[model samples]
Target: MNKKKPITPFGWAIKQRLTELQMDQKSFCELHGIPPSRLSNLIHGTRKAARYRQLVAKLLDIHLTEEK
Candidate 1:
């Protein structure tokens, strides 16, 4: 069976915004003063997005609600 990687809604949104901005992960994190590991954790579902969602949303100019 082929399993798809898990991604949260916030992660999806952040990725979309990153693509829109033409920014890479390392540059984005560095420019925003966000630790790469933390962002990586959120993207890969290794950590709860709740911890970093707000900050990321603000940085990405996205509005995120707690519904998902």
Candidate 2:
């Protein structure tokens, strides 16, 4: 039997925040200046670039750890 891995804490937090804000992918992408396809891929499990993550945290006004 294979076990499925959980999403990373950061990724999970981002997903939750997006849901809480009631923002859709297209709107989120536009707000963050990220390509729609790229944001979609990230939500689907692609690791977002570090810079993109930082920008996201700032734009969404979510506090991220220093390690982020």
Candidate 3:
């Protein structure tokens, strides 16, 4: 039997775009209204949630970018 581990799709996606934009955690948090500490945790993979990351994605316009 095989069990698959859960994935943090939103967090992973955000991290990717941030890297692409050459953005640091502080700047990204400031731009997105995310608490610095919380953003740090999320980016470091210490946190996981669909709703929060979805909001982050939307706020950062990642969803729109993905559509293009």
Candidate 4:
């Protein structure tokens, strides 16, 4: 049906960690040398690039948990 999907555990983790650090996604992307668009895609689970996923997780030091 092409319904919008929920944010993944990894995505939520990234956002949560960013919020904890009091940083915005744009700033986090810029600071980490990641394109904002790519980060968005990564969070939305559209970007399936393993390398980028690993880089983001490592850089953010995030542990993923699905919130309900």
Candidate 5:
């Protein structure tokens, strides 16, 4: 049986965009001036999405509604 690994929403979106851009997490973090550890925490769900919502939206080129 084939199994899929689970990922957090933030992790999936960032990973998808990075794959499309042929980029790596380290490079993306450096280019965006975001600390790698912060991204890592967000991806791993150690940090709440609300904590970095705006920055994450900016990185993904999407606008977040007020409720988010």
Candidate 6:
């Protein structure tokens, strides 16, 4: 079964922007020097590595506000 993987809100935003730019995760990670695993953690809210998360936001030109 090819089930759709559920994405977190942050991941959704990143995915939307990536889709608009026609960019893929591996390419984006390589371009920005972010390790793929870290990116996964950030998008999933698994790890709060502030520096790397900030870098991703900056590179994507996105502003991430507090969830609540």
**Separate clash counts for every candidate:** 0, 0, 0, 0, 0, 0
1 or 5, which is superior by TM-score?
1
Give the C-alpha miss distance for residue 57 in model 2, angstroms: 0.9
Q: Estimate each model's TM-score.
A: 0.76, 0.61, 0.51, 0.79, 0.69, 0.83
In terms of lDDT, which candidate is stronger, 1 or 6? 6
**In candidate 1, which residue ranges exceed 4 Å CA deviation?**
1-5, 49-51
Please give the distance, in angstroms, between residue 42's alpha carbon in candidate 2 and its true position after superposition: 5.0
The digit string of per-residue lDDT tens for model 6 on 1-68 reads 85434556878888888888899998999998899988887777777778987888888888888762
The sequence of per-residue lDDT tens digits that candidate 1 reaches over residues 3-53 is 645877767887989999999889998998888988877776677656566
Name the candidate that leads on lDDT: 6
Instruction: State in Å the error of residue 53, model 6.
Output: 1.0
RMSD of candidate 4 to true structure, Å: 3.8
Worst 10 residues of 3 by lDDT: 59-68
Error of 6 at 18 (Å): 0.9
- Write the candidate numbers in order of decreasing lDDT: 6, 4, 1, 5, 2, 3
| Model 4 residue 24 lDDT score | 97
lDDT of 5 by residue, 1-68 (tens): 74433466767677887888899989988898888887876666666657565686687775555422
Candidate 2 global CA lDDT score:
0.68
Quantify all predictions' global Cα lDDT against the true fold. 0.79, 0.68, 0.63, 0.80, 0.71, 0.82
Residue range with the least summed lDDT across 10 consecutive positions in model 5: 59-68
Q: What is candidate 4's lDDT per residue for 1-68, written digit by digit as tens?
A: 87656787788888998999999999988898888878887788876756677788888896544333
Tell me how far the alpha carbon of residue 20 in candidate 1 is from the true structure, in angstroms, after superposition: 0.3
Model 6: residue 5 alpha-carbon error in angstroms = 9.5
| Candidate that scores best on TM-score | 6
Candidate 2, 1-68: lDDT as tens digits: 75534555666667788899999768889876797766544444456566776777787677776432
Clash pairs detected, candidate 5:
none
**Candidate 6 RMSD to the real structure:** 2.8
Count clashing residue pairs in model 3: 0
Model 2 TM-score on a 0 to 1 scale: 0.61
Q: After superposition, how far is residue 39 of candidate 6 from its true place, in Å?
A: 0.7
